[model samples]
Target: MAGKRCLKGVDIMKLRFLGACREVGRSALLLDDNVMLDYGIKMGEPPEYPVNGVRPEVVLLSHCHIDHSGLLPNLMDIEPEVFMTPPTADLANLLLKDSLKIAESTGVNAPYDAGDLHTFMYKTKTVDYRIKFQTHGYNVEFYDAGHIPGAACTHVTSKSGESLLYTGDINTSDTRLVSGAVEFPNADYLAIESTYFSKEHIPRKETEETFIESLKSTLDIGGNVIIPAFAIGRTQELLMLLDAYGIRPYVDGMGKEAYEIMMKHPSYLRNPTHLKRAFDNAISVKSSRRDDVPLESSVIVTTSGMLNGGPSMYYLNKLYDDPKSKMMLTGYQVEGTNGRMAMDTGIIENNGVLQQLRLKLEQYDFSAHAGDKELKAIVKDFCDRGTKAVFTMHGDNTEGFATWIEEEIGVQAYAPVIGEKFDLH
Candidate 1:
């Protein structure tokens, strides 16, 4: 959809919700039909993509999570100018290539080929936080999102002085990896994720302690502890946490490469040395060593965080019948994913067969996104700063969050549906 011109000889700032309006995944937002923020794909059986047909002149990517940056290469035909932080660029490259490989191995049709990925990479420009840049008649700045390495909340303004602040994904509390997000930038409109709008996290320290206790108990019982983690942020955070607790786990899957990629961009890390030490202490699992991982009472960190695939599945297949063993899931499991299915039914479909798991299972809140209170604080901060409107999205209960913003924050709030467009004025 294209932006419409007003009769007053002014360009109207139109906002379109192409995806991630009321649910998580495939998060694409079009601003005046020229700028796109976060073109990502939702992971599932066939995988879901954002609504097609808009060729954004500029794409402001917020982070490197697959749900946020998965489909960037699909726009290679337009050769859209893409902007992101340095680490985000590198990590997105890693993930996009990995996504293609996974798709081919699973016989799923990939949306873009290697040629698209190469073209997309060539067009990507890495920008630092707080630096002002212009693209397609819009001024843009990046603010640290604290969600992961190189994750950013974007501030954008048009030549006409109309502006918007889009919180791609944010975390307000410090984690082992990144610091809390920077303060909000005042703008006319605010668009933010509400992933944990109705949920508050257990204090981070307490949650870590509980996780450690469970892990130790599982190991003391003469069983291996398998931790399924996301490759980018969660895996590194878990490694740091485990290092602090004097545990050297066997790390496997793409997380190994992600750790290496992150090391090249040390400025994004809270403590590069600490992460280095953690990685040095942990064992890297190679294909030849995969069979050796489950022989002892050790902690193994692997990926496909949702247990959809990766070495985590291999370990589960090996030890599923062992009641003493435990599989500790360490991230948000999207609905229809193997992790969610296993959590809810104790059965996960793997390799085209359904298998009941006898191993002890548990989920830990190691999310990179903000919690309930933090999310509200983000909304409130923008509202207090005179943001004219707030748009809640990227969660299941966004409508409730929007209602809260109207009732408590006294700002006009909207929960947009896919394909809905609004004149921001």
Candidate 2:
């Protein structure tokens, strides 16, 4: 809680990293001991949450992804006012409810219950991008981050005039769903995600074409194509991509509900009309009709993305022994997840029994986060705006990314560890 004095003798702002420092998951940061950003949980055998104990006056979420917003229900006892975009609130509620069901089925105790969810939702206050508001002594604004339907970058200014910007998950390159993140007012302190700092994404068009070709190849051989995608963002993006390529896909799982949610907020999307068309072109899979899905020469899109649980497992189980069938992964497979194991070892455990996969497995880079080159461009833009200090987080190699940022951008950069604190002047 120590602060440094600024040039005008005003106390500088303080930052504490609660989670998502050296690795990607459970992103949380405490600002000035009163306001918090992104209380989340890492997905694994036993989920991991952000450090607890200190209760903030308010919590500001950057997005609704599980890694960024999963643990919000845990804070319901404190009843802190939560702020996020309207879409984020809705999406987060969906994800949290699903998490509770998953935990119940697996015989694990969820940190919070239905009552907590109700309380969390009751205290939530939705805000649109660029609208300035007051929370405690800080002036806060949200900026579109272009990572998902309602993802945002949070910018805050202390009463003393010091400013800090937290770039939640960001994508600087435009996708079929939304435009890339736009430039915003610069700040003295910047916290950026480095999820793909050391990697470069393939050209978007090239990746799309390749994926479509693979899908067509599988279907041509009378093999079913199973695409396991995240329910929210990736699912919609894949639907649009398939539609644009003139392919009809069967949509299943929570993605169908998520799509309906997105349709409600047309302003947050790049092309609402196009999305609508994509939705119309895709066949929505109904639970009653799931048994009727064509077993061959068809494409199916389902969720849980990681193969942990969901309709994807049902589809995978049916296609496991079909050598001609293809399983396409459309997002990052975090370490220790069922998806990663399937990708790396071609083995999946079901009902405590190990099953070998004989289907063709492939992964495509349809990630929503920006890649290394795009991230560098973002850093360069902020540096040009006189950002003095940068804190890197939400990646596997934050330390490496921080070093590169400091040496290449000529600005002080650090990859903080969990529970570390810093005084910004």
Candidate 3:
């Protein structure tokens, strides 16, 4: 894909890497005049770990994933102009509010509170995809990222006509939830995330088949299938696949609890499919409720994805000891998180209590992130016009992506360290 770019006498517009340059989590992309594509925090690490100054010129959110959207609260210091797509804005509010609650519940004194959440919401303005908007002399356009509902990859063009595309987190070929990253006709700089690059992709059918087989095996022995999924995108995607693949279990309260939280918004949902499912399956069960059905036929999908919070702990505590019960993780469990600890060794104590739970576990790539082959396809398209340079970040797999991008895509792609800056004119 070459011969599509038309950059003539374009000057101005700079790119900066604030965080997640080569790391998998904590994504922050700073632009000229402090407009950020995402102001986020790292997983497991303190969201505001360094206590450094990151006053973005302004902030634009791609989606509501905490890693991509968590740092908006700190903008209270910068007080930058914040723009989000309508649904992304809505979901971000829910996510950030809940995040504050989670932090406080865990007795971690968070910087921002409910008052800051309200103020942040008031500052957040919604922008539409494919439509151009102006901010501090930059023309920014949005495209459906397809990684999550309301997620978008942004195309920012300087007043001087220099353009850069920041793919917050992209999925080139997953359609279970969102479609896929949109192709751009013009882009000078492509800042892409390479979370799963260098790994051979498992065919979608194979992934689904693996999930079903695991479920069937657990069900056969009367065990519960506990899926530790992130509450936002991956959880919904897994639920849809389970329903599509004919493994509908009596969904528990986690989805319902999340939706009730969503209903506080002026609009219902960015995508209403799973919202309706959660509404339909709003069943409440006491902690001591007895299980009449065997564990094999039951399914439980809980959030925090990495066993960090929400109903995941409850499911693990309840079913961990049962031989028929199984835990299948469908997302990346950050290192040192509860999910990683469990996967590393099938043991996790129930919170502060010393009582432990154990279960046979199998993990799959149920979580959708752009992998190596997918990143190559996007870069191939972006650099078709002979892009000036390619910037790769937002991954733990740095060297692997660097090699593939140079060899396969044939572009000058590099993953910069945190706080790095580039002057492209």
TM-score of each: 0.97, 0.96, 0.88
Expressed as tens digits, the lDDT of each residue in 236-335 for candidate 3 is 6666677666666544434544444444442323445654564455334444553642455678766668777676777777777777778888888777
Clashing residue pairs for model 1:
none
lDDT of 1 by residue, 29-135 (tens): 99989899999988877678888999999999999998988988988899889999999999999999998998898788898999999998899999999999999
| After superposition, candidate 2 runs with Cα above 4 Å error | 1-10
TM-score of structure candidate 3: 0.88
Q: What lDDT score belongs to each candidate, Candidate 1 first?
A: 0.89, 0.90, 0.71
Q: Superposing all C-alpha atoms, what RMSD in Å does each candidate have to the true structure?
A: 2.2, 2.2, 4.8
**Cα shift from native, residue 415, model 3 (Å):** 1.0
Give the deviation of candidate 1 from the true structure as CA RMSD. 2.2
Model 2 lDDT, full chain set: 0.90
